[model samples]
Target: MASQIQYADVEVGTELPAASFPVTRATLVQYAGASGDFNPIHWNEKFAKGVGLPDVIAHGMFTMAEAIRVVTDWVGDPGAVVEYGVRFTRPVVVPNDDRGGLIEVTAKVAAKLDDNRVRVDLTAMSAGQKVLGMSRAVVELA
Candidate 1:
């Protein structure tokens, strides 16, 4: 599918819609099962805390995927993304609670590239702490 977003309509500093993802213990468990990443740190609070983490944490890949929804949602086509990468800066601690953890993502057009493409920079935060660093995606626009 072609991107609904047009390159001519975007600017270097334009902001895309922000997104928030709710991540609970159940969410982590589901992701673990789906990805075959049944790591103790992601599902066992005791194991996580024993390893010096505050609590069971979300998987890095799951967090990365959640963060990029902002870009995919904005572009209106998931395949429009040509490249995406991020550095894991901190863990999204998921405590055993009703509220759980929230991943807040905000993105902006970092640059207007050639060939109907644009670079989007993303910031992902959880528990008021930045979890992903240098998060960026190169997306093709119609």
Candidate 2:
């Protein structure tokens, strides 16, 4: 299938719409169950604090997936993403409050490649700190 977004319309440095994902303790639990990553650092606050973390943290993979929503939402096809990766720079701390925390994601086209593909650079932040660095996605567009 072709991407809903035409590669011709996407220019270098074009910013995609930003999105914020709420990461609650409950969200972590559900993700743990779905992904089978039942690590205590993602759920147990005491354990997380014991490890010198500020509080319970969201899973790295979860944060990565959340960050890519900006690209997937813009491209309108998950399969259009040919490659994606990121470096976990900081933990996304999740408070036990009703609001929990927010993972704010923003992405921009960094380069246009051959074969209708574009390299998207992404930034994921939480609590005023950069959580994901060097985040990027290579997508095949129409």
Candidate 3:
């Protein structure tokens, strides 16, 4: 797919628009069913606490997907993302409530690379704490 972003216009240290994703208990349940990861820590608060977790936690993969939307949305094509990676620094405790939790993501173009590519650095935070560390993506621009 062709990228919506033009490589000639991209600049190092350009900040993309920030985005936020809500993580509810139901979200975790649906993700578990879809991913076949029936981990109790992601759905059962009691089991999560018993396992030494603060509460029911959102799946790391789910969080990663949510964070990358900032990049994909900006590039306007999922295929534009040629490489992506992140370190799970903290658990996003999704409380069993209507409000649940919110994951806030902010990203900036870190560097312009050869072959019409750029490195984007991402920051993911929840509940006033950083949840993902060293999150970065390489995208090919049109």
Candidate 4:
């Protein structure tokens, strides 16, 4: 699918709308079941703390997926993204509470490429700490 956004209309440094995703204990369990990442660190608080984490944490892949929503939403097509990558810098600590943890993502066009593509840089933060570093996506625009 082609992106709703046009490459000709986009400019470097244009900010995409920011998005936030809530990560609860149930969310982690569901992600674990779907991704087959039944690591204790993602569900068991005691296990996570025993391993030096503050508490139960969200899966790294789950956090990365959530962060990319900003770019996908802006472009209006998931298939428009040709490349995406991120370095896991910190864990998203999901507390066993009603409030849980919020993953906040913001993205901007970093570079315009040939063939109607643009590079979007993303920042993902959770609990006031950056969780994903060097996060970027290359999208084919209309």
Query: Tens-digit lDDT track for model 2 on 1-142?
Result: 5689998998999999999999999999999999999999999999999999999999999999899999989988899999999999999989999999899999999999999999999999999999999899999999
**Model 4 pairs whose backbones collide:** none
Compared with the true structure, what per-residue lDDT tens digits does model 1 show for residues 1-142? 5999999999999999999999999999899989999999999999999999989999999999999999988878899999999999999989999988999999999999999999999999998899999999999999
Superpose all Cα atoms of candidate 1 onto the true structure and report the RMSD in Å to 1 decimal. 0.6
lDDT of 4 by residue, 1-142 (tens): 7789988898999999999999999999999999999999999999999999999999999999899889888888899999999999999988888989999999999999999999999999998999999999999999
Q: Higher-TM-score candidate among 1 and 4?
A: 1
TM-score of 4: 0.98
In candidate 4, position 69 carries an lDDT of: 89
Stretches off by above 4 angstroms in model 4 are none
RMSD of each: 0.6, 0.7, 0.7, 0.7
> Candidate 1: misplaced stretches above 4 Å?
none
State each model's CA lDDT, in order: 0.95, 0.94, 0.95, 0.93
- Residue pairs with colliding backbones in model 2 are none
Sliding window of 10 residues with minimal summed lDDT for model 3? 1-10
Error of 4 at 104 (Å): 0.3
Backbone clashes in candidate 3 total: 0
lDDT of 2: 0.94
28-118 in candidate 3: lDDT tens per residue?
A: 9999999999989999888999999999999999999999999999989999999999999999999877999999999999999999999
- What TM-score fits each model? 0.98, 0.98, 0.98, 0.98
